[model samples]
Target: MSVFAGRYDGRCAIITGGASGLGKLVAARIVAEGGKVVLWDLNPEALAAAKDEVGATRTYALDVSDPAAVAAAAKDSADALGKVDILICSAGITGATVPVQEFPIDSWQRVIDINLNGLFYCNREVVPYLLANGYGRIVNVSSVAGKEGNPNASAYSASKAGVIGFTKSLGKELAGKGVIANALTPATFESPILEQLPQSQVDYMRSKIPMGRLGYVEESAAIIGFMASEECSFTTASTFDTSGGRTTY
Candidate 1:
């Protein structure tokens, strides 16, 4: 048996932003560990692709920022897979790289909507199910920018900082309730999200890392997997950093 063998056997999990990047990686790992997964995403094409890869029987197309949609998705997940044992909120946007004063209101709002509000919606919907089952694990994907805001991406920084605060409060509320919440901060990761950004912004991000390279998606997924498993029992309301030595983590 592997080190994580039998760890998530028979457990049910929900992975938002599950269609790509770190979310997709982590979802695959959870399924490989004998757990059931409900993949929630907004992109039909991406969702369909993931469905084909992970099986259509386990995916749902929905926006994480929509509370009613998220609640319904959770119900669908629970009804089909039994109950939610773990949930990973990994959907987010880096938004436009600019000073806050110069940032477009719409752009800044978009980041907050998905990165912070989406997290709130998912947790809001899942908490009841976890409370009912008396067990759950929640992992929110944050960023090193959250710990120390960057110069040109105030929206991304602010949104991620909100995630850190939200996770900590949720963790406190779920204390001793067999439900835990934590955030993961990854800096300059070599993930698909970077594909959407400009070279200059990417260069700026890469320059901040003490390790002198972008972190791998697989490495981030591994840490997320541990936090989702029963092995992460002692940590909650905490920020797990994977910044390649940037921001002191």
Candidate 2:
């Protein structure tokens, strides 16, 4: 049960990467709070499962890195939800952990494509719907790696940094239009995404956290819930830190 009942009543949200991890959890939270959601992910099977698990109103399987796909999904999402009041861009990947000199060119391109370019496409396509309604919330998921620049994870770090910069620009553009945009920078969190990294890399990330521990999905989801709600009326063009003290700024 949600502590803040009806916080998202009558709201409609489109959550990219809604198949798992933070996105899936956030979807469940919004549904529990009386909001409608359309889940988008690259994995069709996972999307189906997530739709059932989160009680999502609709689900779309598409690669967020594809501009055409994102554009189409945005239109379909708006059609499904009637109006998109919230957009949580949570699709991302931790590319191969390797030094810049040794980083695979394809890996780098994939990281930037999905994490940076894909977010841009989603935001570009959805902002019109938000503007039409005169009210909306955008939470773009970034990472503390963007700020601290994690070693051997150059692509992930750089891509996330782009997310931060892009979100700032978008937030400013949408300011005073009743559509708030912000970025979420989370430190090393306990998530399935970590499974992609080596144990050494995970250890390195955990060591950077002053809390001496990884953050839980629920902790970050709680923050996102507020950011996506009507209560987040005044804050825009800002970054919310959930870095377990790894990033103070």
Candidate 3:
């Protein structure tokens, strides 16, 4: 039932955080469109379940924050898939909800490590494979919080902002090489990540969306599907907004 049927024919993708939420949803779309995918996630059990659910070609228990692990997984994925055509970085956390002054230092560091540094490692290791093929798509998930900093979510916002900046730089570097990189800035979405936040925090985010509701996973996945396809050929090094009108700039 995919309008994008056959759009991904013969393509192979590596999706971090492919175990659930947006990552899992995106994997389903790619599979429905005739692409093969290799999933990477921190939870082996979830990874296994996701692979079965989405019919992924492979799964790797990965901690993107670990540079060595990311590197090894990248090579293994390429070896297994023959080539990697797309990378969807959706694995992230909201961290503890608290004012910047009260934010736990450890929590802040953890958010930055996983949300920003981890993404950097994945991109660095995978770009070589993409460059070798001279064709690739990278979609790094950011947040509306990144564009307009949210109170009590400083770490998440800052890390996502870094994602935007990093993706911009990478897109430029890969320009004219047939490889493209972009970032996704979505407003608060109805996701498992919301469970980590207090209800008050979630409500605050929901209130910011002019659409009067949180975004659906499918809605975000649709944009990602397009961004990670040949149709996105000319729009490299840019940020695609999915903020439900919360971010118009």
Best by lDDT: 2
Please report, in order, the local distance difference test score of every candidate based on alpha carbons. Answer: 0.86, 0.94, 0.94
Q: Report the lDDT tens digits of candidate 1 across residue range 1-249.
A: 123667779888899888988888787777777788888888878988986676424788887778888888888888988778898999888888877789999998888988999889999988999899898899999999999998888999999999999999999999999998999999978877887688998998899888899899888888998899898998999989888899764
Candidate 2 residues lying further than 4 Å off, grouped into runs, are: none
lDDT of 2: 0.94
Over 199-222, each residue of candidate 3 has an lDDT whose tens digit, in order, gives: 999899899999899998888999
**Candidate 2 local lDDT, 1-249, one digit each (tens):** 345789889999999999999999999999999899999999999999999899999999999999998999999899999999999999999999999999999999999999999999999999999999999999999999988899999999999999999999999999999999999999878888999999999999999999999999888999999999999989999999998899999
Clashing pairs in 3: none
Clashes (N, CA, C under 3 Å) per candidate: 0, 0, 0
Cα-based lDDT at residue 174, candidate 1: 98
Which scores better on TM-score, 1 or 3?
A: 3
Ranked candidates (lDDT, high to low):
2, 3, 1
